[model samples]
Target: ELEHFEMHAEEPSYWPIIAYPKAWSPSAKGTGEVIYLQIYGEEDLEQYKGKLKGKFVLIDTIRNVSPPFEAKASRHDVESLFEMATAGQPTPRPRRRNRAGGFNLNKAIWTMLEEEKPIAVLDRSYKGDLGTVFVSGARTAEGRARDSAKVVIPQATLSVEHFNRIHRMTLKGETVKLSMDLKSSYTNEDGMEHNIIAEIPGTDLKDEVVMFGAHIDSWHTGTGATDNGAGSSVMMEVARILLKTIEETGIQPRRTLRLALWTGEEQGLYGSRNYVGDFFADFGDSGYTPQEMKPENENVSAYYNLDNGTGKIRGVYLQGNDAVRPIFREWLDPFEDMGAQTLTLRNTGGTDHLPFDGVGIPGFQFIQDPMAYFSRTHHSNMDNWDHLSGEDLSQAATIIASFVWNTSQRDEKLPRKKSQEEELEEKREAKKASKAFKAVDPAGSWSYEVEIPGMQVTGDMVIAKNGDKFDLTLTSDYAPDEKEVIEGVQIVDNAMKFDYQSEAQGMLIDIKMNLDFSEKSIEGMMTAGTFGSFPVKGKRNSM
Candidate 1:
């Protein structure tokens, strides 16, 4: 008989803990002195060098958090749904700030903490004000995991109320103590991780595959429910539904329906990238460019992925492939009532589908509603089964299953846009066109005048070209003592940019000029350092 261990407390009593070496256990129990390590910089650790050993350390300050009274879970509202269907812009990602200083400081702090050997590290939960303790992986001293080297530590999180109490008690000169017994075990003896793959094989096109996948691995906190557990569940249910359909309807797909549950996605799309590299294309040394494409690259029809959260499918991101717009529109027609009608040319990144897309495969991620994935559940301790919407998951599974079925049963493989090589060539040609300006007239001299705040300066410029590179020499009344010449300039379209220095009022001033050429006139801006920029216009001097 299986035994169940349950906690019967009003507040959350069974808080989660992360420890190193997974097999290690702390059996000691009793109240001991707790130390709050408010070390943000590397030098701060020197003050508490010997104080952290044998004492629980509070690493973060207690923050004030409130219960989420607002609706944290919701499907797409009508207005938002309409906007999603019609909007042409991609979901704007938040700009990332440079964290090199913070990262180095943290690295130093962890290293010093490991050397100091604290009894345990405690942090306040980021969310869950009342009793929710969102937890994640413990920090290794060297900052990352290594095969042979594991900097083990016992780490835990406390609710905001409990953590604040301890923090306040310490601030008031009252001694705070804690008792902890943390045990964990590590296993990966074979040094292998696998992605779960199952398929409904096709009779005529058994070799060609249409893949639908979601990342299975997630943060240790909160059972990874909304972060990816919802996606995993939906993809699994899709597999089951497809199997039943095949069994009942007696219609096997023309192309194979392969379900892939990927791992290490949160760790930078490792599983899917490895899969693509192994079978489809070689990512090579750069990790972005495809160097060698394997034979299996042509065998894939498309890869569909879902990982945005527990939101139902609203539409699809076409990843800039306009050729498939009409085709997807036709497919989405039947599911208009289910709200899966949008098809945008924008690209959505940061998931497992990118690897396939990188190799020119028709890979896509569905458009989904926000649904508190960003504000609450994603990567937080609050990410659990309760946050998942059953209706949304069922709808997602149904839509994705139909998409997979349609792709598999299509008479031809899904249409692909230009390959990476062709796209790169087009970009190179456009760049060439942008850099090579048309010679409007044969090499000649043009007279121009610059209008400044206090002065109008006249200048004559001689233009010459050698192959595609252009050169210019200017003599202006503002700086008649010095001649400014620029060489080896490439004109983008009809515009050319060059830098020159002139002696003005006993000061050597640096100036940047942009020249635009037409059949009858030459116009430009002369930007002198600190003095300001002035408009310069010229006409071709008649010989």
Candidate 2:
């Protein structure tokens, strides 16, 4: 029996409406004259607070849509795949300085909308053209759109063509009127979700496990076919193939094979991260800050993930685990003819496997062919069953199944890179060994001089230790009467980093300081907003 699935707006006699409602948008209906407002800052938002009531407000400018010159779909050629296979460590880019005011325009717009109570808000899709409008969740001033206490107004992303038409009509003094009835509701009010986990018990090494899975959730605009449905389906197919193989051969795997279908990956890998924290490690606050590892950490060999799209498996991204290159190469030898031989030491992010990799377990994501996943389907209304390739998914399942089987049959657990905790301990020991030669502490008042483009300014900084944190205060001689208190200061080894706001010439400036300390002197750079970095040096004051 065919049942109705979730869809956007239904066909009705509404005034020229073809756009879809954003996910998590509340049910609402209204007919009003369209109002175009482009807010840049807080001042602009304040000016339009009382003017937007009961109007369908257009909140963005007309986007430029160029004709597609390049092909919409392509696979990684041999040269590109070879480049990935031979890729070395990526050079770290310089840190970007924060904007002057650090003001968030998008958040401000949503906050103003909530306060002004617009009949409906509309913006053009950030990407795509023709009739494809990429849609995501609604936004609130605070908390997520799904939060029970958060108020989510009716919002929809209009197609670029329609948006531009409306924008042009508004510019010509023509009254453009649109009526929309966005019918939506909250189904999961309790806000509870789960990760589906299952395992095939092993014979001799049942305690040890090899895991494989993908994220099962996707944005609501489409059926989520290419964004993640492809991955979820492939993993499920792998489970069926492995189960049937076991039933036919009567041979049990040496290590337990676990299959996990993770939820909430699109919302920042919450499901996988929580699972890892619960079973393997104690992630104190974030994935990088692991308090301790559980005994179960030793039993997991590796985790394999696939969430790129319907692209066939071209190779594997080693994710900086060089030790597995030879092992994986041997495993891929049979599939080399099928275009799955390359292995790179680089890392691929934005997926569910990251949680396992963060905790030092050997985790891997396959290198798949790029087939319109990013250009047309990913997070867009086109991410449906039609965009998926059956042949590509089959190839992916075959390669992943073999990789999982090979891992389960291995005699030892996959080799691991050094964990952050272990590296920190090593660095601490090295610091202690070298402390006798040059000892320094950053807990004193220091007089510093900074050399800007055309002038030099002197300042006094006072740093005090308050338990585990440090307190910093700065006063420049140029403005001797004013003092700036610095918050969220972090001191690692003999280096200090912090940010603070400074008022100069009636404008608020955001500044960041990175200072390194010697026995009795400090040296580093002070980065002022827009003006760039300046050299800074200081001497410790006598006690």
Candidate 3:
């Protein structure tokens, strides 16, 4: 599991060197224990062997912050959020889930590259808070943003106070004797970011594709041990096992299997999204609107994303696809003993798969135990090689490998639910015809025609105008305004809660339940919202 991007924790190291004239003078050879070298190009690290020369370069930029492990472990914020989501009583909390305010490290470097076009970057990872420097970004709400971040950038490091000596010396009358020893860095894996990609070609349906991925890039601060360092390794391991097993078993997938180790995942799912967008666009996914992107090819299977912190696999999120339950049930049969057995039809987001789901493509994010990830490691200073769990990772890799294998070998493609955006628009249009749609209460005097799920999450809500009354009946779960108690309306607040209710006034009879009103939320504080009914029975005279 730790084999892909092998975790390496770098112990603290302190080194020293001296500067020289033209960086070659013998007098300056042993002058000092510390040397401040300036880089001259995107690939050149200015290294002087003996003396001082041209420009005195400012070098190093890195930060380190520790984790409040004990404090975080006691807090169950994440636990509450996940549990509430699974039970369908979505939280009312406003979660930002945003990265630190931007334009700092990534931007400053990119901007400097754009303007100065330096040979290379000099960076020093900060260990504690005493040595501090804050950088800002180039964007605000008003300006037209620049889009020059097209490639992966490179970086190097030095000590802050040691490097500052050159800055002070050059500012004085001293022409700061400095030298740079630069080597060609962009020659190999040391320079550019590589996305490891592999694919299992489909046999029966060769046109379809099922992609799986995780980011591989991490801050140089601590070898990126966690905070996605583990994610990258896990995905690789998953790929390895699946490929090996497929080869050993001689099993060919029905859909193409592509695995990608994304770049700039920490910055955002840049690599994965760009890849998906470009791939689908090239093959014509045909996303005319921002919400719906269906390729002309029906063979394209769903995309599976695994990016939760490294913990034992608990279950796989369905991403609101109730239709996927049976399929997942079948696929999970093999790994039921591994403990990844639960499948909930709840929507979970915040990762690469979000982009796909936003565009109407079926995407799934697996649920995993967080373990001590949030409390102690993750992106903190403590996140190092030793933070990873072998057994947990192995368990995860096994499940993911099997999942990818099964998905790739599926005979038909996964189905995508209607985009929420389109559904919302349809709902808005349905409201205009107030008189056309009516709500009839089954208990009051309405007739029952069909049966549906015990809890109706949502559906068409129509209240028809009939003189003094509103005729209403829902095709799904429903609730009405309880406090005001409209002349003929029934409210389903905690005290007067009712899962099933019917209303009939003269010939019109209808039965419906409010989608928002659930038996689960019997104690929580809730504010009132407007309600609607549908006209079913002959209640035209009663209205």
**Candidate 3: segments with Cα more than 4 A from true spot:** 1-85, 89-194, 282-298, 426-543
lDDT of candidate 3 at residue 497, scale 0 to 100:
20
lDDT (10s digit) by residue, model 1, range 1-543: 001111111111233322211112122223356778776567787898877778777777878766577875566677865654565422111111122334456657778777887767667654555555555445564524423446655566666777787777777777766666544444556656799988888879989999999999887556789879898999999999999999999999889889999987765677898899899998787554469899999999999999989988999978667788898999899998987888866566668888888787999989897787866777666788988889989999999998899999888999887753354345445645775534464257889987652247898888787567766667777545335566667765565667755543223345667666676687656655433345568898742
- lDDT scores in order: 0.70, 0.76, 0.45
Better of 2 and 3 by TM-score: 2
TM-score for every candidate vs. truth? 0.69, 0.76, 0.49
Report model 2's TM-score to 2 decimal places.
0.76
> Runs in model 2 with CA error above 4 Å?
1-15, 90-107, 285-288, 420-543
What digit string (tens of lDDT, one per residue) describes model 2 on residues 117-222? 8878887776788778777666666566766767877777888888887888888877766767666666666777899999999989889999999999888878
Q: Which residue pairs collide, candidate 1?
A: 22-184, 22-185, 22-186, 23-184, 23-185, 134-381
Ranking by TM-score: 2, 1, 3
Which sequence of candidate numbers ranks them by lDDT, best first?
2, 1, 3
**Runs off by more than 4 Å, candidate 1:** 1-31, 66-69, 86-100, 125-128, 285-290, 417-543
lDDT tens digits by residue: candidate 3, 323-412 = 777888788888767766777655554466655664556877777776656445544445678867788789888888877777776666
lDDT of 3 at 311: 70
